[model samples]
Target: MYLTQGLHRMLQMNPAALATVFRGRRRSYGELAARVARLASGLQGLGMQVGDRVGMLGLNSDHFLEYMLGTWWGGGVLNPVNIRWSVPEIVYSLDDCDTRILLVDDNFLHMAEGIASMAKVRPVLIHAGDGPAPAGMLSLEQLIHDSAPIDDMARGGNDLASIMYTGGTTGRPKGVMQSHLNLWSSAVGRMAEHNITPNTSVLHVAPMFHTACMARVVTQVIVGQPHVFVPTFDALDVLRTIESEKVFDILLVPTMLQAMIAHPDFGKYDISSLKRLTYGASPIAAPVLERALELMPGIEFQQGYGMTETSPVISISGSENHSAAGIANGRVRSAGRPALCVTVRVVDEAGIEVPRGTVGELIARGPNVMLGYWNRPEETAEALRDGWMHTGDGAYMDEDGYLFIVDRLKDMIVTGGENVYSAEVESAVAGHPAVAACAVIGVPSEQWGEAVHAVVVLKPGLEVSSEEVIAHCRQRIAGYKCPKSVDFVNALPISGAGKVLKRELREPYWKDRKHGVN
Candidate 1:
């Protein structure tokens, strides 16, 4: 049940097999295992304890895999920072979790100093980039070369494995604590649903910090398959890598899939080797799904649905649901049945199970569910009630046991596959000096399934333009969480309790949409 057990199994079964591929670099299982052990030793040298949190601020690469395995091997928990977050946000996470060791790649090296300066405890930085280590930082290569190989610490079961931070409703990030068993159960459940082919290569185009992508990483390790990585999601790079690497599987959000299919040079690549395409983070539009099926006729498309709290897998719509027959029957819209390890139900506010076709909050109880949010006992209790994780998502279960998500009860917006809490955005918008009051809502968008839109009430004498408001928000929050558009209004509709009526603000934008969410 230990996360690093897969590495040991791979070493015993196929030591010389290709384990990781990134850029022009490739590492065999033997080499990867040895390096991981050495990296574990290095962590111990840097004062990492059995339950210490090790953070990585970087892109998807072979080194990222090493860091994950090495941390577990050293008996340290993972705290993979969000790359899109600003330095203040990053510092907040590091400070919140007391992360004292951070690995930074070239893309994030510039922010390391700022993070270290702002953090309550300045983290020891390890350079994980391809180039030479900069001044005042330890090199990842040097650490592996200098340190002796160490045995796996064998931390497993309920031991904390990762502390992934997700957008919070209170305008901050909440660290979701996932145990080794939670991750193992999730990966195993997914494998049971759709088995991976032997010796196949899986592409890592999605951000490694994300729970969905990291779960796939664990699944690949368990299956002992080759991992092919791209630093970031670029349509051309993904197509080229698939053709060059002979990739068998990939996980993408609907937006990334659409971009790849719509790319002008997409037809030039020989991507017949790809066997499976798993998409999630947001529901795919029918037209986009149709186009993807038409473009990649051989590839099987599957949809997964969940949150960071569920170890990122609650249900998965199989390839069959994406088929023409399933679409005709309208089953394609479902999030599919609960995973093998999970028990899912739609329940009312009173915690009673609702009848089929009744819209209610989706709740799940499973081994894969996260332990709780770090340092937030009250919030944890509020989310995990009666032994079931109350997912703040509005969904309905049909007679066939399929779940259909209609809205996000938490007022969370999924724009370009990234969760943006309306409260978080509203807080930033209201920070502007010219603003009196503001309400943020998700508006229907063609490019990004849902775009963050803000309704603002300016002060009596002050005025601010849309661009100015957006610029102001950029200083306080991530770019993705900033409002895509802003509308000046006299006043927002409010309930008797002094809360903004978001539905009224969202109504015009989602007028003809069947679901409240895009």
Candidate 2:
């Protein structure tokens, strides 16, 4: 179905209901619907034709949501630029996808100018921030107020909805083509796995540019839930918002969750309204999960597992899977079963389904699978082999069909003759009492071809020696999988989405080597 159908339904059925809350500003469904339509008309007037690529470069906000809906509402495709990318990287994506219209907030307004100067075809910039538009940029407010509201374009099914660029493993970003069916299936599939109510108030803290959070936004739209937006994630601000707004649901990365639970003033807020906490991008450490459960006794936790190519939701570890019952059954450690619309299999290089407990690539087949990569047909064919999207993530399925992701196939360390998944080592290292965070990677080794190397960050005022870290891991996992060496760091290099960037960690070590892997 069309993405804007939910908005249309909301306007007809509950126009007076609260649609969004951002920084003390609240808009009713009627107001939001009208603004969205007007914004669509404005973009149309600015030369956005059907299936034209439109870009948004900004932090999360109510305006960001409007841009998303308004783009599809106007029968256009979205190219949401990653906020963390440099001018050159952002320019590459825009140039690659031929994004002609770019939306910028206060943070990226200046960068927008830089992008415009460098691009072959300078884009039309729409300012979507609080202040007035700069000299050349179009004001978002002016557009909505001046333009007449238009009807939804009703684009659906195979229509291209978004071209989401993911940071490429090979150092160049690739645009993932997500159709309307891809996004719709993911949103509705997730809703089927959760207990979303009419009164569900979802707090969107993660960057809207990421597919994980955007998928959540679509689900909230379909359910007609009130949305609360924060420009960025701050531990104190998150806690305060939860208390003040009586928010019911939130999505966070494990690192963000760690900071929130560790905040000294966490107990000061009355957060009983919080009922659901959904996390993804990385697996949660046992300590972090235990602390979260202890702190928020009644909250149901869900772990979503997927990447940008699958409209970002493949499997979901539901509330029960995070509870005592499921944990005892070994489901908590799993990525959970496939989503309502997805079919998951652990396949070998030959694309044959491996026996249960055999590690192989986790391939998924579903309507939620992306249409293809933009302008990368060879890569697209390589990824979408046969009918399944080969996820490049190394995982194994148990007898119960719960998928346990080991590591990225590229990130797996081949030491001597054995394959050592980095996640296995990281999980063991994280269990250390003094460890705050850790990432494991493969380093060059004359003896073993590639050695397991662990980079760790300890809790403040706490220390653990490299020997101790290795010794701890030895008790939990195999010696080959254990770190042969450890380097203690103040912090791990993390992506904007809170995942430890292993590629960055391996870069310095692998710089002199011809190949990426040892």
Candidate 3:
């Protein structure tokens, strides 16, 4: 169950096999293992003790993979910072977890100063980019080159492996604490159901910081397959990488998949080697799925459904459900049955099981379920009750045990594969001087699956333009969290209890849609 066990196995059985390929830089298993060992030793040399948190604020790269394994190998927990978050959000997350070592890449070098100044305890900044280390930052290459290789710490089982932060309902971020066993169970369970083809390389287009992609990294490591990476998702780069690297498997959000398929040069590359494609984070539009099937004939398609708290996998709709017959039968809309490692049940507010076909909160129990929310006992108790993780998602189960998600009970928005809490956006929107009140909701989006929309009521005798409102939010929150559209209204729809009626506001945008979510 150790995270580094797979690496050890590869080193013993196939040390010479290709381990990673990143933009002209490739490494064998033997080389990667040596680097990970040295990186672990370097962390130890920098006074990183067991159970200390190490954070990385960087885009996707082979170095990101090393940092993940290196931290665990040195007996430390991981805290992968969201690259899209504003400086304040990044600082809050780092401070919340008491992360002492922070890694920054070229893309985020400008933010390092802000983060260091704002964080409660300044972290040791390590430059993880390919370029030379900037002033006041330690070079990752230098550390690995100078330090001696260390032995594996062998921390596993109930040991805390990562503290992934997700958008919070209370206008903050909640760290989901996952154990090594939790992650191991998830990857193995998924691998058992959707077998990875032997000797096939998996492309890493999705950001490695995300749970979905990180879970894939674990699965690939367990199978001892080569990993290919691009800094971020670019349609042409993905196509070119697949052609050059012979990438056989990939996981993408519907938005990325749509962009890649809709690219003008899509047919210019030889992607015949691609075997399986998995999509999730948000539901896929039928047209996109159909077009993908048409363009890439014989490729297996699977849709996964889960969140960070469940080690990111709860159910999977396999290739069978993507077939023409399945689509015609309406089974393609399902989130699929319970995963192999999970026990799922739809429950009422009182925790009683609901009848099949009735939408209720989705509850699951499994080793893959996260241990708890870090340092938030009350929230942890509320989410995990009686040995079941009560997912705040509105969904229904059918007679055949398939789950169909209809709405988000927590009022979270999934835009372009990123989760944005309405409360967080509303808080920012309300900060405007001319804004007397505001409510944020997720609206249907053709490209992003969902877009954040803000409905506002200006203070009496005050006026604010939509552009002004959006510009104000940009300063307070991440650009993705900023409202894509702002509606100036005299008053927002309200319920008897005085809470803003978000459903009413969302109705116009989501009307006639099969599911409330995109």
Candidate 4:
């Protein structure tokens, strides 16, 4: 079934049930369905053809959900712009995919002017904000009010659904092509593992731009359950919302959870309604997990592991793996076995399966695998060789099929649940006029799983401070991708072929660490 089919089913089954709640506004299934239909018709009327890519740049909100459903209902593809990306990065995605129609919230209206100027063809803007429509963009509310409901296009099964841009190894963002089937299989497989009830209410604190959070959203829609949205992740807001809204299940990164439990006023909130807590993007520290368990004795904790190429889930560490015994026995450190619909293998350089507990590249073949990287056939072939997605994560599968991530085969840093490629950071750092050479590496961090660290060699007679280097990189890339710490050197160690030996630079920091990432 298509993603929007569940919405139709909900309309027929429980029209009066709560569908979405954002800020203080609530919408019943009946109201949401009508608005979604008209929005779809309105999008089509504004020149969205079948298979056309429609873009949305916004935070978590009811409008963001509506934009997602309406785009699919109108038979168009989706491109969820990363909110952390700078103007140049956003424009590159819009231009790369030829995205002509864009929906912007009040938070991103300021970027519209810069995006319009940089893009090859200025997109047709639709303002999805509470305030009045800006100069040249059409009002989202006006579009819905002025249009007529249309039929569902029924796009499903291998149909191109989304083009999600992810950090790439080649110093640029790679658009991951996800089909409807890819997303559908991921959500259904996760739900089967979780066994979420139809009455479940999920809180959306993670950004919708992320595949992990989007997977959660898809599962909630399939089960026809209520969704509670907060504009963004805040420790106090999450605590208050769980108490007041009675949120049943919520997905968060370990960092957010750490902040929530560490909040000074955390004990003041009556959060007994929270039943399940799902976390992913990076491994959780033992102390953090122990504190979480101690604070919420009745809460079930789960962890999922995968990348954007897997449509985001290959294996899941279940609630059972979070028990006191499981944690004590070290099962909590494992990424868990394959999901119900996925096949996972740890393979060596010769493309052969390795012995249990032998570190190797994790490869997966499943319906949830992405179609390929958009417009990069060579890169796609390398990643999807032999009909399996070769995940660049170095892992070892135990005799019991529990996967333990040891290192990243590719030099990618995952800070606070965001992937920051070393090449991207290096490129940004090397662009500074004062620098001659640079190498980026991931260093262990308590707050972030890994923080991006940069080593630089300045040009002759040139000087640059660490803060200045960080500020320079921030102008060119996202803040998370910038170096958390910088070290100035006279010269970098290079091999005969002129490649910087990043291993030498990384060895000191990871000398005593068990895992490459924290």
Global lDDT of each model? 0.88, 0.91, 0.88, 0.86
Task: Give me the candidate number with maximum lDDT.
Answer: 2
What's the true lDDT of residue 400 in model 1? 90
Error of 2 at 451 (Å): 0.9
Tens digits of per-residue lDDT for model 2, 413-448: 999989998887888998899998888999999999
lDDT at 261 for candidate 2? 92
Q: Which pairs of residues clash in candidate 1, taking residues 3 or more apart in a chain or in different chains? A: none
Q: Clashing pairs in model 2?
A: none
Candidate 2 lDDT score at position 413: 90
Quote each prediction's TM-score.
0.82, 0.98, 0.81, 0.81
Q: For residue 499, give model 4's deviation from the true position in Å.
A: 27
> Can you write out model 4's per-residue Cα lDDT over 428-512, one digit (the tens) per residue?
7877778766778999999998999999987778898999999998998888889999999987764221235676788899889
User: What tens digits encode model 3's per-residue C-alpha lDDT throughout 1-518?
Assistant: 89999999999999999999999899999999999999999999988999999999988899999999999999999999987778998999999999989999999999998899898998999999878999989999999999999999999999999999985434588999999999999999998998878679999888888899899999988889999999888899999999999899998887688679878899999999999999987655555667788999989999999989999899999999989887898888789988998999999989899999987899999999999999999999999999899888888899999998865676878899987767568767877778766778888888999899999988788888999999999998899999999999988764211235676788788778887853
- Minimal lDDT window, size 10, model 3: 493-502
Candidate 1 Cα misplacement greater than 4 A, ranges? 412-518
Residues 286-387, model 1: lDDT tens digits: 556676888888788888898889998999889888888988998887888899989998999899999999878899999999999999999899999988
Cα shift from native, residue 451, model 3 (Å):
16
Per-residue lDDT value at 48 in model 2: 96
